[model samples]
Target: MNCLLTGSSGIVGSHIMFEWIYKALVEKTVNHLFVVIRNNKKPAKDRLLAILNDSSRPHFLNDFSMADCLSKITVIPSDLSNIKKQTLEKYNFSTVIHCAGSTSLQHTTDSKEKVQHQNFNVTKQLLTELPHNVKRFLYISTAYSFGIQKDKVTDTIANFKVQEFRNPYEKSKYESEKYVSETCAKKNIISQILRPSIICGRLIDAPFFETPKFDVFYAWAIFLNKYARKASSDFRIWIDQKSGLNIVPVDFVAKAVLHAFLQPNIKELNIVNPTQILHKNYVGDVLRYFKINAFNYVSERPENLNNFEQLYYKTIGVVFEKYISVPDLQFQSETILKFINQLNLSTNLGVHENFMKLIDFSVKKEFKSSYA
Candidate 1:
């Protein structure tokens, strides 16, 4: 049976296109593949073909040829909301992986009410209008869907006790995931919910140490890169000494997505790093890359600040500070380790090992974009 994939243009989705879909084609597990990429300046096939045809992408994750994989795939150029029923009937899809959604973390009313909530709306719309032949459904939800978990986060959903979310994106995913799980149970569809925590660059899998977007942690890296001047000198940046952020590589995420499909019995999987780079060590490489020596992680908030610190906190820090100052939540991933183990893929380390590589790549890319 064939599979229909959404969000083929995103970083995680594109990685799956390069790695999992290619591997699946070689293994003959999937007879064919269908991709739903929204129309942009170019047709969906042309846009997605450009990404798949990148010869410079790293290997060792999969050894399939691009041309062979291309022949087995069909492009459906439609938005998630716009996919017609006739298209599903014609394709006769057995599995649908819904990975397309807004990742915006904005807390503005318009963003929360419309943009971020669009994830939930689109997901609901798709599930409500699914074809009877679609027996399996996979929803790519964020690990942070735990919202503001009071303590540890298990693979189980009922364990989440968060009343309020840090941002609308987190809240939106939580709502969407809840809807997917509950709806799938009623419809008798095999549902696999994969929650990925802060997807970044690769550590082991193909395109080793590569990332499409330098976002999340890399945004902070870019900030430090910008702060390379004398202006940030002696200006303290506060961090949580005990808590850590769960940032996993894109390849690791792609691996988890593949395994989630393999082990459907193991429904919910947190495709998160086995370990987190505690807030204290999260910025170590970026700080070193920029030769930054002014920041320190403190359990308690600092009352005193220099002029720069004052200005920084009042401005961009208002948003960034929200990320660090939150309750500690340990994401459980041992259940999925059974599947990850089969592939002999390593996800033991978090973002620390290749942090500098990400910093270098992002900084250079940012520089190029800024100048270009």
Candidate 2:
């Protein structure tokens, strides 16, 4: 089987590539792996090699020589914003894994246009470019696309109009999901949409600084830690203290995607952890991790925050308020869980371990200085 994958340089896409290439190494089920990447300065092969050689990869690949694995793949360099269909006419692929999309939550004019083009427009264009022989189209989406609906998040497409989205990113994913489903149906294509919520880092040698487009959870944790350090008195960040966040690690997400890709029919799957991270525990753990006792989580916004605290929330918190203020929602995980069970895979759904790993990586990288 031949495959075409986009966003091979991204967080989730990198993980997917790692796993897919590993499978090829073992069983050789995939005949050819074509990676679609966008980099003007560096060649596509160099970018793929970089991801494979990164020290932060899953621990299982530490002993394997990446050179052998990297040689088995092909890379195509293109922005994909307005890719012509004729450009891909020569290659035949059985699967197309679409993982390229903007994850910025910023609300600026530039951000609005980026989210629209990257998420919605890109998917629309790719659907037209897909070969007629392609059997599977896997699209990576976020469970938050359900938006601010503090209710049950099922394994299905969300209604973009009825729900109130937290930001343009969520809104864009919702719109893109609609387009993907409609186009695939009309073309008689098999499409699977997988929604993973709040993706975190792996425990084994996870990268310190992720691409800014992704890694919102880590960014939030690091920002809060910085704010705590600069505050004179105890400070509280406003959030629904009781809300729960479904923070799943990348290894789990990658395995889930791999399993979903093999299945004959899976319309939609919520690739989320059954366990969730409560807001109080998250803040409490973060404070404890930093060895600081000056921070807390509060339901209401503090009135008299200091200059630094004011700036922190006004800049970081306000941009992420929609995510932090969200109430806990139930995620339907029957299909995904069944798939994992059938594969006999053990998944670590603990939030504390993953959170601490991220904190450690951030500290080692001195993200406080770099990001600040």
Candidate of highest TM-score: 1
| Cα lDDT, all candidates | 0.72, 0.73
lDDT of 1 by residue, 257-368 (tens): 8767766686888887777777766555566668766666555456787666666676556656767765456776787566567767565543676666766877766732
* Residue 107 C-alpha lDDT in model 1: 66
Worst 10 residues of 2 by lDDT: 204-213
**Native-referenced Cα lDDT, model 2:** 0.73
Error of 1 at 313 (Å): 2.3
Instruction: Give the winner by lDDT.
Output: 2
User: Model 2 off-target regions past 4 Å?
Assistant: 62-64, 158-162, 204-214, 340-348, 367-372
Q: Which residue pairs of candidate 2 clash?
A: none
